[model samples]
Target: MSGLIGKKIGMTSIYSAEGTVAKQIPCTLIQAGPCVVTQVKTTKNDGYEAIQVGFDDKKEKNTPKPLQGHFNKANTTPKRKLVEFQFNKDVELGQEITVGDVFEEGDFVDVVGTSKGKGFQGVVKRHGFHGVGGATHGQHNRQRHPGSIGAASYPARVFKGLKMAGRTGNKRVKIQNLRIVKIYPEQNLILVSGSVPGAKNSYVIIEK
Candidate 1:
């Protein structure tokens, strides 16, 4: 699949007109590139085929020496995000791929990003556990507790992979089949229907 590295600008609602009816559609705003092609891999060269592009600028002094040379080879400045996609099109180094070039209104795409972190959470919030059903019947602070985890003597130890409280979110998530609602080519912005993972200004990948 071909994709572009982008940043999640935020989310908003737009009015979509269907005949005489106006419907409100919630959408996520993403700045979908103006990415520069940094490298192109081929089966004979790198044992596979892919296109590597860089998005967002960074200070040259902050970039490592080897990475600086790599960016220099592509005739581009140091970038904060670098992503590789299996693009079938031929592109030269330093070629810029913008949102308009890859996606259009009404096109469906898949967005990949890191979801917002929730830190350590209980089973009720993390795994949707109902917790203790009643507040009565000696259920004091046991409401949000995980209750019993293991059997008595038959299986003394708790089973692995059981749903339990743990760190939540801050993980890679892919939202598939998100329709492209609109495009602002000059602004390098794309509006995708429905919600996308990640916090505002976080990096995302829009795949077709």
Candidate 2:
């Protein structure tokens, strides 16, 4: 399936044409496509079939020399986000792919993005730990603590892949099968129902 690189433009409510009171829908607005193809990979040469698409305008001063050269080859300006997506059909380099080419209203699509970063967290917030026993039971400092980490006189060490708190969020996340509420081709916008990963203006991939 093919996908488009887009920027999340926050969210807003979408009203129904029927003027029904219960038909108001909340959706996240995304600025999608009009992406330019930068590279095309083949099975014989690259051992795969995929097209690299670039989105969002980036200044040459901010882009590295090598990447600038890459954009030069595409005959387009620098892009802020570049992502490779494999398609069933073949696509040529420097081809322009827009949102209308792949998606339409009421289509189900998956959105992939980087979730917001949350530094150093506890088990309660990270792992959904129910805080030791309860709010009472004389919990004190052990209320939000992760209890019984290891066997006492046995292994004497915490097991690997334990749900201990360290870092939270700031990871690649994909939300699947989100319904496409609307598409504004003239404005290069797509409205998806429900919240997507990452903050406003963050890059996201919308895939079929």
User: Which candidate leads in TM-score?
Assistant: 1
Name the lDDT value of residue 179 in candidate 2: 95
lDDT of 2: 0.90
RMSD of 1: 1.1
Candidate 2's TM-score? 0.91
Q: Write the residue-wise lDDT of candidate 1 on 41-115 in tens digits.
A: 899999998889999999999999999999999999999999999887678888988887888889999999999
lDDT of 1 at 36: 95
TM-score of 1: 0.97
The sequence of per-residue lDDT tens digits that candidate 2 reaches over residues 11-118 is: 899777665555777899999989999998888999988889999898899999999999999999999888999787767778899899889899999999999999
- The Cα RMSD in angstroms, rounded to one decimal, for candidate 2 relative to the true structure is 2.1
For every model shown, the clashing-pair count is 0, 0
Which residue pairs come into collision in candidate 1?
Answer: none
Q: How well does candidate 1 score on lDDT at residue 143?
A: 83
